[model samples]
Structures are given as C-alpha cells and as structure tokens.
Target: MARDRLHEMRGRVAIVGAAESDEVGRLPGKSALMLHAEAAHNALADAGLGAKDVDAVLSTGRQTANDVPEYLGIRPRYLDNTQMGGCSFIAHLQHALCIVEAGVAEVVLITHGESGASRVGMGGGDRFAPDTPPGQFEMPFGIGGPPTRYALAQARHMHEYGTTREQVAEVAVSTRKWAQRNPRALMRDPITVDDVLSSRAIAWPIHLLDCCVVTDGGGALVVTSADRAKDLRRKPVWVLGTGEATCHSIISQMPRFHVWDAAVMAGERAWAMSGAKPSDVDLAMLYDAFTIVPILALEALGFCKPGEGGAFVANGRTAPGGALPMNTNGGGLSYTHTGMYGMFLLVEAVRQLRGECGERQVAGAKTAVCHGTGGILSASATAILSTER
Candidate 1:
C-alpha cells in the first residue's frame, strides 16, 4: 500500500503577510498605485517586518497599477514586473520561489491595483493597446473589454454543452449566499437562481447578473522563507506548489471554445509539485468573473467529471456548509472585480488558512487552493497553500 505523502513543503516558502484595501465602490482621490501601496504597507505591518527587510518586489503590471518595490522605496536584489493577466499574482508566487531558490532574494512582495469603477483604462489609448511586444490578438478586434469577451465565451459554452440559462444562474445564487455573510462584499442582497435567469441578457447566454461588477481595489502579499515566516508575528501559510500555463490568444483561432485546457495544465502541475490531490484541498477560491467561467473550470481542474459540473455545483454543493466551501469572500461576482480579480483570491485564501475570517470562515481549513484565469481563458495559474508552517 502506498503511504500518504508528507505535507510536501513541510513548511518552506510561506506567505507571512497579506492584505487588501477596503473594497471601494468608488474612490475619487486614491490613485490606483496609492491603493496598492497602502495594501503593501498593511501586509508588511501584519508580518511585523519592515520595508527594508524585503529583498525583492513582484509587480502585477496593469493599465495603471503601481510597482511594488519602487513605491515602497526599497532596492531589492531581485525585481520582476510579471504582468500576465489576472493570474499574474499567482504566477508571481511561483516566480518568487525560483528567485529565492536562485539566492537572488530572501523576501518578496507582490501587489496589484486597478480603478475599473472609475472607468480607468490603461495602455495609454482608447483601449488596452499593449504595443511593446504588441498585444498580438487582443487589442485589434475590440475583443478587449472583459464583459464583451466573456459574453462571447459564455455563448460558446451554452452552444457546446447544452448548458441551461438556469444552471448558470445557480453559480451566482450560490456565491451570493456566501457573499451575504461577508462584510467586504460590494453587492449582497439575496438572489435566487431564478432571479439570475430572469435578469436581462447582456448577450445570448450572458445576462447582466452573469457578469462581474467592476470596482477600484487593490491587494498585496509578503512572502519569505519558512524560517522567516516562523519568526514573524503571524502564522505562515506554506506555498506548497504553483503553476502557470497559457493557450493561444487569437480568439477566432483558439483550439476549442468548450474547454479550458490551461486550468488543467496548471492544476495538474500544482498538485504534482505539492504532492497533493483534489481531495486534499479543504476549500477553493476559484476565479469567477462570469458565472460560466467557474463551471467550465470545475471540469478542467478535475474537481468533477467533465460535463457534470452543472450537477456538481447544483444542489447547494458550493453553499456555506458545502462539501467544498468555495469563494467565501464573494469572489469577483459579489466582492470586487478590479481588472485583475485574481490577486484578491490569493489574499482571501491566505486569510482563510490563517483562521482570520470571522463569519464566513471554513471550519478547520488546513489547506486551500487558489486558481486564477487570465485574458479570457488565454492564461491560467494555480497555487496550493497550507497552514502547517
């Protein structure tokens, strides 16, 4: 008989600190970077560590996001401006470990910010025009805005899977139930699955409620060696494993519209590296920009049999007292949807593992999994964390 694998990291690379600014529905004076810096300061303070102790900074490049190290006034031995989309923050976790292993940095900082509620668009033009390497397939077709692009993806999902209007609504209803218990959520009243089905469709198979709300918010995290985390003021949530992968971005030319292969690729890598399995994770903080994204991701991530996700998340399986407690912070659906909602998932995951969540907390949550999808299923990332450290 095979023996259970020991907690893979045994408490190695740990998240010593994490934070996010208040979910501002609207903030006039706070620039995007200022909010980011504020979160960074809070995280550093939570860890009982100083800015000077940070040896590297990981910035999530946004239309107007700030640099983590530059704004903090630190000269780290390592620096990474990794801007890969919503999943970039999780990607930064993976990148920071490599940097630390290479002896380039001892402590790392990751920060993300955006003012989407203010209609703040980056790239210095009418839309997101990333001209440096050139946004090969993103900018030209007006396939740029998240809502419009998600509409296209949702349409394809229904076409291929026989996915119903009611089933998609279930995702929102279930998450909203959890959101009602969260004080940080921006939209919380109580929505039934029928309410979602009745809402006006933004596009076919894409209702107004199906889309995520845009807000101006930012989040940050401080990572250090297991040795450092144990010495810090707070408990350490070990980064057992992480992975990132991308598919072709050319929407018209994508291989298949029905599946999310990136999530599979990244999920398998993260699980293997951590020596953990789907059953090992007690909770999941899935990136839910649209109702349909998580349904597809459940299959792609191997949480359920392909094509059975509709039933998996049905029957209150993802509700408060769920078999697998999910999106306890309301997620992008009810919480906040900055340009990159993915970073917020990580912040919430760390908080859950630390048992810091008050009402919506998952009981005895020893392990957590964070999944982020970027650029309309163009890229994906995964991270497994535990509180053993």
Candidate 2:
C-alpha cells in the first residue's frame, strides 16, 4: 500500500498499552538498553501481554531491531528501525499501523530509550563526514549545535512577526503550570513570564526555561489491530491518522526560518487523513524541544495562522483552563526530555484520551493531536488519536 494513503487505516489499528520507564528525572545507574527493556516490560504488562505475545518490534536510537529483540528475549517476524531523531517514534507508530493493518504483525511493540543526562555510552559525532556541507561550511564557523541553529529561526520569527520575548516565555510558563500537577515532572515550580525572562539565556531568544529539560528515561507502546485491541487489557486509543515528511538535514538548507514547510505538509496530510479539522481536536501534544517549536507547530498544524502563534499562546490558551489544552503532561519543557521526545508525546496523548490524567486532563477529551519535530525542525510527523471506535 502507498504510504500517503493512510486514511484507509482509520479505526483499523489502535494503541492498547503505553508506559514509561522508572522515574524520568534522573537514573545515573541505568544504561540506555536497561531503560528500553524496562519500558517494554511495563507496556506489555499494561496490555496484559508477555514478550511471547509480541510478534513484531519497532525502535529507534542506537539500538537496532536485533538489539532490542535480543535484549527483550522476543523474536518477531517484522521489525522496523526508522530513526529520524526526536520524531522517530512518531514515524514508527505510523509505520506500525501500516504493518498491522497489512496483516503482517498481530502485535507490535514500539520502544525508545536515551540516557541523555548520564550520557553513558551515548555516542556523539558529526553525522556528516568532515568534508561534507555541514562539516566544511556550517560546522567550520562553530554554528553546529541545536540551540545556535534554532536561535536563527527564533530570531527571525521575532523580527518578522513582531513576536516579543515575553510571548516566547509564555510557552514555558504555561507548560510549567501543567507540570505542577505531575508528580513525575522534573520541574514543577510555578514560573512567571518575568521568571522565564530572568532565567539564564541559552541563545538570544531561547532562555534556560524556554529549553526542554534533558533527563534519563524511556517509554514504550503496544499497538495491534483494532479487532485485537478490544480483547486486550486496556482501552483502545485509535490511530485516526498519521503523516510524516522531511524537509532537510542541515539547518542552512531549510527553505524558510519563520515557517517549517515540512510541519505544514505533514500536519495537513494528517488532518486530511483523519477527516478532522483543527476545531475537532480536543487536546494537543506538540513536541516542545524548545518553546519556539510549539509556536511554529501551532501555526504549521493549522491551529492558527502564520505569524500568529506568538499571540495564540500568549494569553494562556494552551494552559490548563484554556480552550485548547496542550501538553497536559508538562511536556518536554517541564516533564522530561530524553533526547527523542516523540514517544512521550504519544504516551501523554493516549493517557489523556483514556482520561487517566487526574489533574491535567482535558475534561471529556475524545480526540488528540500529537506532533513531533526532529533534527532542528528538519523532520516532522503528526498523529491524530481518538477514543472513538
């Protein structure tokens, strides 16, 4: 089947189980592989299944399909290793839906783990060779890291849209409000815009609070055919639609700084596939690797117009009491960011749809939209989930 034709997948597959590894804030003793195994076990338990029940496996990061299967002691007929950074998990979920709907896998386990805080065995180096464009041109000037590259876009957004520093800081302040209700959140203290502005600045517009917290953690999901999910342990969170796209690998190659073209394309496809408009969405789990990301995503996802994201989030619309509740689980900014945050986004969305979030739940939420950005806003993926059949 063609990848673009995901609308046919609606109500065909559902997420039956989801879980995170041990406490997210810190785990100095745990290796990345250990975290992955823990999450996989937890998710299987949540689904009332054992490793033997899983006939397929999907994962990202340094771990290959073979690595995960070997560590977990399960042999699967199908395996997927689609790693595109933070949004890799989102893409994996999308692929798993197709795999299951095609009758290739009865039950699939998608997992993610990163010892970002400990950095124990976390390999790092330029993805490109020394003589490549990034190595020869961009890296030579010392403008390599994510903060520097994202700052260029944030600065441009501020200039083009007259977006203020306080408007950007509002994202942090609002997300922290949700974090206060989550016991597992790393940073739950209440923060005002003034507090965010006063915090140390990482880049010009990106402050310490504006950036996502890096911790050691892992998360996993159990997906199966809708027919099979109904017989499983937990309520089904249907995969209504999914879309993914890659714009560029290097920041310099991006078409526009103010707008993420890939996000726009991906979101539009997801919305179309789900037959859902922005108004139909009850909640959002947009990847907040940085405050600016959700801002751009809100626009690209059609929640608001271009250049209007600053105002859309300024008045607390994304806060707990707002019309459109977003990142109800503190999000990457305040919750936990273990490098690739896409898996957590789906986990929170599933919980929200299940009405499991005691304090931060969007009352009567039936539909959710989870969006993820990978590699300096280069790769984008969007998933629409609902509790409806």
Q: Where is model 2 more than 4 Å wrong at Cα?
A: 1-3, 123-129
Task: Give TM-scores for every candidate, taking all chains together and pairing residue i with residue i.
Answer: 0.91, 0.97
Best by TM-score: 2
The residue pairs that clash in candidate 2, if any, are none
Q: Clash number for every model?
A: 0, 0
Candidate 1 residue lDDT tens string, 146-200: 6667666667777877777788788899899888988878889999887888888
* Residue lDDT tens for model 2, 1-389: 44566788877899998999967868988888888899999999999999999999999887656988998998999988887889988888888988998889989999988898997656666476688877877887777457888888899999999988899889999999999989899998899999989989777788788889999999999999978887887989999888999998888889999999989988988888889989999999999998999999999999999999999997889998988899988999999999999999999999999999998878999999999999888999999999995
Model 2, C-alpha of 34: deviation from truth (Å)? 0.6
In candidate 1, which residue pairs get closer than 3 Å at backbone N, Cα or C atoms, i.e. clash? none
| lDDT scores of the candidates, listed in order | 0.79, 0.90
User: What range of 10 consecutive residues in model 1 has the weakest lDDT sum?
Assistant: 1-10
